[model samples]
Target chain A: MSTVLEMLSTPLFQRALLAALVVGISAPVVGTFLVQRRLSLLGDGIGHVALTGVALGWLVGAATGAARADAYAIPGAVLASIAGAVVIEAVRARGRTSGDLALALLFYGGIAGGVVLIGLAGGTNANLMSYLFGSLATVSSADLVATLVMSGVILAVGVGLRSALFAVSQDEEFARSTGLPVTVLNIAVAVVAALTVTVSMRVVGLLLVSALMIVPVAASQLVARSFRQTMTIAMVIGGLACVGGLLVTFTVDLAPGALIVVIAIAIYAGTAALRPLWHRAARPASTSEEARADATDDPATHRAR
Target chain B: MQLADPGSDPDPLHLHGVSVAVAGTTLLEDVSLRVHPGEAVALLGANGSGKSTLIRAALGQVPVVSGDAKLYDVSTRHHAARVAWPRIGYVPQRLSAASGVPATVLEVVLTGLLGRNRWWLRRADREQALAALEELGVADLAHRPFGILSGGQAQRVVIARALVRRPDLLILDEPLAGVDLLTQFSFAALLGRLHAEGRTIVVVLHELGPFAELLDRAVVLRAGRVIHDGDLPRDHAHPHGAHDHLHVEHALPSEPPTQRSLP
Candidate 1:
């Protein structure tokens, strides 16, 4: 606890922790929508695509002899991720049964492309590797600022479009029938999801970013009764996981990305295991609200099983 | 501002030579039909007879290969087609019981009012949703998870969703499918109320079932073409009886109407 307090007092550690907290909050906000729509792995796909963007930024920096390529990396990744999102949308829109197959192909193909591009960029710098495994120590002030701004934009959009996103995600044809511009909203969701994936890669790394996006949401779904409640709980759980993982990393020699993911997975497992206990505790109270919650809760648990 | 007032002139929906083809196989071909204002028209056919596709085509959900689908004289293909959807409320078939997300009955119905113009639900919208649910007698189930509801209860909620918009045109695809018989009568009663409000309704049904009384006309389709587009026979039509369902096969014309392109 003394060591944690000492580290928290440092400006660099504070910035890195703040960045992780931002990711913890915002990634799950967007993730709840994706998971509800059964697109949980879309974050991983976008993360892989973002790697290519990071590689391209490095190549551009090398050619221009810029002081740093990291400045261009996030934006490049955002663009590349959006492109990959559009491709996934297009494949699904084709109404083919093989669309899932196409997405899987794109998912692995993106990672392979990223590796080749990173190799061609000819940078043996540990900075590139840090993007894959995540290093809180490497989060510069500039990267922190960019992460905050980008994450803020994503959060605003996610919160603002919450209703429309829920409506469209739950029922596309019905949303369209109500004049909700289902196609545009879907594309917007894809874009926002891409943004979340790209920014979260800084905290969780490209390889494990999706775990950051999905795990807390899965845990929240087990504990919360309503859509709104689920989102709030997921955000809280994500923040806790981030803080807990960061503190553990400080005490031990471990990769921040891997440790964060492990922490999130543990939270999910813990939530699932404790769900019956939660119900049992609530059963004694037996209030109408509890009864209603119990009524709603069973089908969801059954479906999940 | 006012409840729907039906007129004979501009039909709420008109499918003129609409042909929907998916992957080189025509789902609906040369389907020309019209639902006049305040009319409760039912599209009847066996599965794969294009009843659902025809309704989908009219809503511009499916592509019209060689003809036009118009909602109240506005071409569904027009750029402004989206603006006209608010006037048309649509209810999909009842969802499967195993759907993972447990949206509240109110939440499901509230989505009916969500559109490009209104992304957020106001108190007025909430009241409107409540009123619609109340109208369908599912107001008590407003806070209940929709997935937990019985088939009949769920269908009522779906109907409530459609009625929330107070739409001039209501299109329901298989509203009675998987619904209990007792609930089917209740749904018929609900449709009767909508029809009395002078709303134009186009519903797809495998059999007339309890919906017989509310149906002003029945359009029967066979192999993607309309076989019967007028009155149902007296013997086959149900008149608000406790039991009202005719075997569609026995009721359909034995010779079958000659398949021809709509001019």
Candidate 2:
């Protein structure tokens, strides 16, 4: 308890906490739509591609003799991730092959390319481990600012395009027929999702970032009755998991990213187990009561002369 | 193949010399259809007889290989940028609830209004959505989770979603394909009401069934060619007058909308 309080007062802890909270809120906001669209693996695909960008950033910095090469990593990763998402969209539009096949190619090819690039850049195992497992405590103040601004923009965009996004996610063909700019909306969502994955990689690591994007939203879906409720609840669950994992990391020797994922999975499991009991508790009353209400409310039952 | 008949019908929907082929297989060949104002036309055919493909081509969902597909006298390719969607309402085929995201009936209906230029839904938007539900007699279901509704109720909610836009032309693809018999009666009744209100409708069906009384014309396809197009022939395949009890005229307060002439 004393150590947690002490850590909370430090600037390093403050920066990491800000990054975690921003990621916690923003990841699931975009993630709910991704899960609804059945593209939950998109985060993992983008994260793997971001690794190539991160290693490339390091190489460019080393060649230029920059003081801090890591500072260029986030932009490089974001660019690569967005490009990967666009390529996936292009492949889907081609109609030449199955969408899943294209995504699988990107998913495996990205990681393999990233590994080779990291090796060619002369990166040590420690540097690779930081991006893989995430060194949350090492987040600089600049990273904190970037995470805040990026997450804020993501949240704003999500809220602004909520209806169009929901429409496209539910039925793309129908949305297009209604003039909702289905293609543009889909590309916008993909770009935002890529941004979320890139920023979240610093806190949850590239390998486990998808868990943060999908797990909390999945848990929320078990209980939430509406889309709005599901989005709000998923964000809250992610935020809670982040805070809980951080506090635990302060007290014990554990990887924060792994702990956060474990906490999210625990929440999903608990929600799933308790869902049946909750349904029974909240079950609607008897058929007789429902029929009575329908008799009173249904105009079709009362014929007009 | 040649395009549509060179007639000056000025219909709401007109397809001229349309052909759609996938790979080496011909789905529709040399097909032309025109849906005039205040007309309810049913496209009928057996499975794989090009019933779905023809409507898909008319809606510009599938590319027309040879001819032109126009809506409100505007080419479908340029329709979106020309502010033409507000005049059209489309309800797709029924989808399973398991394959959907959880949303309230109201939220699903509100998606109809999303094609407008507004960024946020206003109070008037909510009221408009409720009024549409009320028109369909499903206002009580506004707050219910859409995934929990039965097939009949879900269909009505989807119709309400389309109707909220107040479209002059409504298109439904297999609206009663999966619902119970009782639900079909309600759908027939709703179509009757829409017809009396003078809204143009184009529906796709496997058979006339309960919709026999509401159709102005029947256009049947056999292997992508229009084999029959004229008045509906009375048949003994299904019982008629199943929806006679639900034929009450709706009490709409507003006068019939004044439709615009073809540009």
Candidate 3:
């Protein structure tokens, strides 16, 4: 507790904590929509594209000698992601392309582009490993601000895209006939997904950012009854994973991103395995007891079960 | 002003050489029909006769292979197709779809008010949705989750979604199938009322015998082509006691026409 409090007071540590909390919330909210739309792969693909942004950022910033690192690194990455989004849309409009194919194409293309660019800009004083695989041990205040701002943008867009997303996923034709802008809705979702993936890089490595966005929600789904319930559970689980990962990382001097992902997987496994067992363990002794209670006219217990 | 075409009041929907082929098979071929305002036309066809495809085409929801489907005199390709939708309400056959979707009757109905013209809906949207529910006599079920509603109840709610738009045309696809006789009569009465108000209604029905008298005209299809298009065959086609369904208290016995019956 004392160590945790001390870490909380330090500006860098505080920044990491804020970033973790915000990312935890934003990931699950956006993730729920993706899962509902059966676009979980799309999230993964976009998260992968976001990696190109990170690589692009480092390449540009390192070449510029860190004079305008923030502007070069962050904005360049975001713009690249937006461009990737546009290209994805354009490809989809051309022929027998699907969202899934488009996503995979952009993600792989981003990765290839990013790696080539990073390799071409070779001389790096900063550790490329840290950006590629994340080092929460030294998350900066600026990185935290970037995460928060991006998460906020993702959240705002998610809220606006709620109905549009729902309509498109469930019934595209009805949505179109009812005047819902299906194309615009799809583009908006892609943009937000890209933003979310871009911002979450500090807590989850470029290779693993999608897992951070997807795993908690997937794990939370084991015990959740409804989409909304799943979203809430995902957020809670994600935040807990972040907090626990941070504590474990700072204490044991481990890589926070990798540790957090392991914890997320563990949570997913535990929830999936234990929820049914817990329900079975908690059930009443006999069906006769439930029958007796119902006979007596007290309906609340029956309702509770 | 935009959902309705300004150039011509010819009919709500005019399809000419409208054919749609999915993958390789021709689903709808050279189908031409006109649905005039204040008219109630029953679309009669056997299964795979392009009944569903026809309904979808009229709403500009399906791709036309060769010809044009004009929704209020505007081709589906026109930018006004988006604007044309709000003025025409479409209730698809199945409300039992999206069984996992969590929405209340009121929430689903409120969706009708959404169109490209409006960014967001206000209290007026809810009010209109509510009024549509009231008109359909399903306002009491507004708070219930749509997934949990009875088929009859859900069908009414879906109809309300179309009716709430207050469009120039109302298109329903196989609405009466699986619905109770009482509910069917009530629904048909609502359509009768809409037709009386000068709104065009085109309904796709597999079983047309029960409500034969309710509709003013019908276009029967045989393998993606219109075989018959005229006033109902009123001259003792069945005399099967099906037409007097509203006066009876029992379920309306309905079986498809012999030629169109499933093999």
Each model's lDDT comes to 0.78, 0.77, 0.70
lDDT of 1 by residue, B1-263 (tens): 46544544478899899999988899998989988888899888777889888988888888779899998788876653354777889988646333344567888889898876878888789899999998887687787666556555677787788789888889999887655555567778878987887788899887776788788898988889998899863554442233344444334322211221111
The parts of candidate 2 lying over 4 Å away from their true place are: A93-97, A284-288, A291-305, B1-10, B234-263
Per-candidate clashes, comma-separated: 0, 3, 0
Which residue pairs in candidate 3 have backbone atoms (N, alpha carbon, C) closer than 3 angstroms, thus clashing?
none
lDDT per residue (tens digit) for residues A1-305 in model 2: 78778989999998888889889888998888988887788888888888887877777776777788675677878888899888876676557468778788788877777777767666764676788777798888888888998898789877677888888887776776677777888898888988888888888899998999899999998888788888899999999898788778978989999999999999999999999898778765544544554421322221110
TM-score winner, 1 or 2:
1
Q: What does candidate 3's lDDT look like per residue over A198-225, in tens digits?
A: 6766777656777777888888766554
Candidate number that wins on TM-score, 2 or 3: 2
Q: Write the per-residue lDDT of candidate 2 for residues B1-263, one digit (tens) a residue.
A: 12123254357788887888877788998888888887899988767888888877877788677887788788774364554677778888755344334678898888888774643577789999999999888898888777666555677888888889887788998887655555577788988888777778899886576788889998888898888788885661331244334322211211121211111
Worst 10 residues of 3 chain B by lDDT: B253-262
Candidate ranking under DockQ, highest first, comes to 1, 2, 3
User: Which parts of model 1 have CA positions greater than 4 angstroms off?
Assistant: A125-127, A284-305, B80-82, B94-100, B237-263
Candidate 1 per-residue lDDT, tens place, A1-305, comes to 89878988988888888988999989998888888787888888888888888887777777777787555677778889999988887777677598989988888887777677767767754656777777677788888988898889878878788888888877777888888878888888888888888878888888888888889999988867667777888899888888788878887878777888899899999889999898788456444543343321222322222
Worst lDDT window (10 residues) for model 1 chain A? A296-305
Model 2: number of backbone collisions = 3
Candidate 1 global lDDT? 0.78
Question: Which candidate comes out best when scored by TM-score?
Answer: 1
Q: How close is candidate 2 to the true structure, as a TM-score?
A: 0.89
Looking at model 1, residue A109 earns an lDDT score of 80
Runs of candidate 3 exceeding 4 Å displacement: A56-80, A83-117, A123-133, A215-244, A252-254, A258-305, B1-10, B21-26, B93-101, B123-154, B177-186, B233-263
Q: Residue A220 lDDT in model 3?
A: 72
